[model samples]
Each structure stands twice: as structure tokens, then as C-alpha cells.
Target: MGRWEPDARGRLLRAALELFAEHGYEATTTAQIADRAGLTKTTLFRLFADKREIVFQGQGELLALVTRGVDEALNDASAWDRMVNGVLVLSGAHAHEHRTTGRILDPILARSPELNERAVFKRSAITSALEGSLIGHGIDRWQAGALADLGIRAYYSGYDLWVAVDDSSTLADHVLAQITVLRGAAAQALEAAAPQPHPAGVRSADG
Candidate 1:
């Protein structure tokens, strides 16, 4: 069961997202957010630098969860397939934990340029972390980075599509279907490239 008592931080983020969805970003103020969260304005600032940061506090955790799953699982034949498939397996594996994440992330990205920029940056970081994981598994730096970003964006696109569709479609199925599409693309892209035999040459990646 979920905790009955309020979690100040969670409440803050949820309130911010709710308000962002209801009133739009520019019009939502710290005081309004505090009122929504049942927190004082000072406490909101104590937890976040400003209103913008409120939308992004768990971003590192998101990247870490995705990257960690990919780093530990490389059974797929090609690094590209692994990256594309990671879009599903890693993200789906954590759907429960990230359930509220999309609710918060989507609206903020939709309405605020600043939040959209932050989302882009977060996507870049996820891409970089995923690329580093691929590089550790013997893929070339530039190729790994490009494909990682591609896979993440593909997942993002699929996720939005899923949301726009009926709620009957689960996020996992949506991402998984997109992962399949991405994997098909990766397989076609790598068909002509000669396989490298040097995972040993790569450096370790952070979790």
C-alpha cells in the first residue's frame, strides 16, 4: 500500500505538475505550488532552487535506472540491438517506479519552453549514459552515441503516442512495440558494417 502520510517532495512535484497542467507554467507561482503541496514557500525553495527545478528533480534517477539496466544486460547479438531493445526492457522493467513520471514530464514538456529545454537536456544525458554503456560493450563512440539518442527519442515518441491513444494500451506495450521498430532499423543499419572484436579495448561505464 502507498504511504498515507504526505511526502513533502513528492507532493511538491505532483502539485507543480498538476498546476502546470491546469494553469500553465508561466502563470503558476511558488506560493500557488506551496498551497497545492501543503508546504510553505520557504520549504519549496528549500527543496528546489526554483519552480523549474521542481519539474526535474528525479531526472538523474531516470537516467540511472535506464543506463544501469543496459550496462548489466548485453545478451543481444549486436550493440545496436541492445540499445534499441534497452528502450523497452530497461524502461518497462521500471514502469511501476516511473508511473507518475510521465504524468509530470509530459505536461511540463508540452507547455513550458524552459521545461522542454530541460527535457531535451535530460534526454541528452540519458542518451550519453546509454551510449557509454554501448561503448563499454565494444561499440564505437560516435555510433553508440547517435544510436542511443535515436533509441531514446524513439521511445519518447512511442510513449507520447501511447498516451494519446486509449489508456487501454499500457506504456510497456507501447515502448516495446517501438523498441521492435527501432531494433528492426538497427539491424538494417548494421547489416553492412564489419563486426568489431574488441570489447576489451573499452573503458568501464558508471552505473
Candidate 2:
């Protein structure tokens, strides 16, 4: 193998995914991934902290993008509006480029509990970051948290749909559509849970 290589990080990530798929996450080793990429173990470690990190590359960038989007929204914007802006920011930047890898990653994470846990942790971290940003903008904590959860769910669900479905829409389009769906669902749930008024002539059994 050459001492210098182009796209080493990309190579390592693809190699790791392939090995994890073939032999399973726990069964695959860093050295095997490195070898599969035609790179050295030292090169792999230089690119990633460990075998697990390879699968989660770009998490930091996404979190930063999410924070930026929410923070930059108009001061008077509603929490849900700010969340939609955040989803648009991140998904527009990353979704198209990541579609191919996302397709491969979804099933691999589904098969591996450890990898899926890490994926969930990364998402939770993004949600927390978004909530903090909303609070910084003077939004109420409860509303901030709820909007954060909904925002993250919308972004990811949109990404999943983008990867699974053959569509002409961009990731931001998919994410925005999902946000609309989630908002409608939340509305229905609240309406269903609301107490209905009793008829004027109705009497309780206790009464």
C-alpha cells in the first residue's frame, strides 16, 4: 500500500461498513477494516478513534449545523419554526451526498445493537444541543425540549425515507414533509386526549 492515499477517510468508512456487514460488528476488527481499505491500521486510527467511530463520521458536523440553524432563526420565530429551519439547514447540506452510505448504514445498524445504540446516542446528543439552542433564544424549557425531540425525529425520519424511497425531492423537502406529518399527528393526539364537555342534561352516576 502507498504511504499516502487520497480519500483515506472515505475509504476507511466504506471498508468498515463492508466488514461489519459481512462479519458483523462485534466480529469485525479494526485491522480487518484497514486491510480491506488497502490501508494500514495506523492510517485507520488516524482517521477514526475506533472501529465504532468510523460508522458515525460527520456527527459533530451535523450537531454544529443543527445548532447554527436554530440559533440563526428569527428571534420571533416559534420553536417549531426554528426546528424546521434547523432540519432544513442540516439536511440540505448533507442528505444528498450521504444517500448512498445511509442506505447501507440503516440495515447494518438495525442488525447490530451496539451500533444502533451509538446511533441513538448521537441523535440524542443532537436533540440536546437543539434544545439548548432553543432555550438560549428564550423559549420555555418544556416547549424547547418537545420541539427538539420533534425536530430530530423529523430530520432522521426524512433521511430514512429519502434513502428508502425513490423520489425527486431533496432531503430538505422530505424533512419538511415529515415535520408537517408529525405536527398533524401531535395535533390529533392532543385533540383525542382533550376532555369533552358533558351534555347539559347529563348526570353522573355518583350525582
Candidate 3:
């Protein structure tokens, strides 16, 4: 068996996880992770260009899943429900479910001056991808854009709170309830904006 080389990628992932959890992200090293994985540094480099890349591979899959969910929502769900569901799906479920990988990436990125500068740019990439998916949902362009922004903000706010509180409430449960509130607010706003009807005789299509 190749031992270190047979499953280099799996070894890298496990090594990175253990090292990250034990020594924290920034303190951990690619060489150390490679060593722990029973591989050479060159093999590690061949498998992964940099340490940060290891933490981010999952995001590509998740973003794809989110896009698929958004696209599927176009056919059947109400505009509001689709947007809401998209929001919920993007956030994922537990801290471990959607957050651990990002969480690991976040602190590492934050502490590095170079990575910090690029963080917003990376986030914008995801936001744009999501915006495209929202537009594909048959929502008006402006409303879809606003819904995407608002949904992410609300979903993340709830997500962060849930994480901070350490409560039993699931992320899905929390986000679904929040969607009802957002729907209510959006409905109220639309209702308030509807033109008031004139008395029957006073009404005219245009004149």
C-alpha cells in the first residue's frame, strides 16, 4: 500500500483537521500536516497548493448545491418561499454542517493580512453566483436582488446567533420561522404600496 501516497488527499484533510483543531489554524503548517499524514511535503504540495485551499474545497460543492436548490425552487415554490428556502439552504443546518469549514477558513483568513484583503472579493464571487440563481427564479430583477441580499443577511444573522447561544434550536427550524417573518414584512410593504382605489366613478385607467 502507498500508506501516505495511496490516499494523499484524505490524509491531507485529516491531518489538516487535527492540526487545525489542536494548534489553531494559523499556527498549523503544511509541512506539519503532511508529516502527520505520513507524507512528504512535496506530495502535500502536489495534492494541495496551499494550506488554505484544503479548508475551502467544500465550499465549491456547497455553492453548487445552493445553486441547484435555487434553480429547482423556480418551478413550484412561491417567489417568497423560494427566496426564503434559498436562504435557509445556503446557511446549512448545524454549526458542524455548514459552518465548521468556513469557520476554520474565517479565522485563518482574518489573521492573514493578504488573505483578509482577498476575503471580500471571494465573498463577492459567491454573492454573484447566488444572485444569478435568484434571477433565474423568475423574480423581478430588482426584487430578486434585494431578496438575495436580505435573505443572506437575515439567515446569517440568525445563524450567528444560534451559534453564539448554543441552543437546541436547529438552523433550519430557526431560518424557516424567520422566513415567515420576512414574508410577512414583504407582504405588508407591498400592501402598503398598492395604489388606493378611488370611488367607482372617480377611477380611470389613464386620462
Most accurate candidate by lDDT: 2
Candidate 3 C-alpha lDDT tens digits along 1-207: 354447677668777877877787778888898888888889877767798776555556656755766776747787666766666676663455444454554565555665565556555655666677878766788877777666765665666555555446777666666666776888899899998888877857784
Off by over 4 Å in 3: 1-14, 17-28, 74-76, 93-110, 115-119, 177-207
**lDDT (CA) per prediction:** 0.75, 0.86, 0.68
- Candidate 3, residue 132: the lDDT equals 75
Candidate 3 lowest-lDDT run of ten: 93-102
Among these predictions, the greatest TM-score belongs to 2
- Lowest lDDT sum, 10 consecutive residues, model 2, at 90-99
Between candidates 2 and 3, the one scoring higher on lDDT is 2
| Candidate 2 TM-score over all chains jointly | 0.91
Itemize residue pairs with steric clashes in candidate 1.
Answer: none
Q: What are the runs in model 2 whose C-alpha is more than 4 Å off?
A: 203-207
Prediction RMSDs, each to the true structure:
10.2, 1.8, 5.6
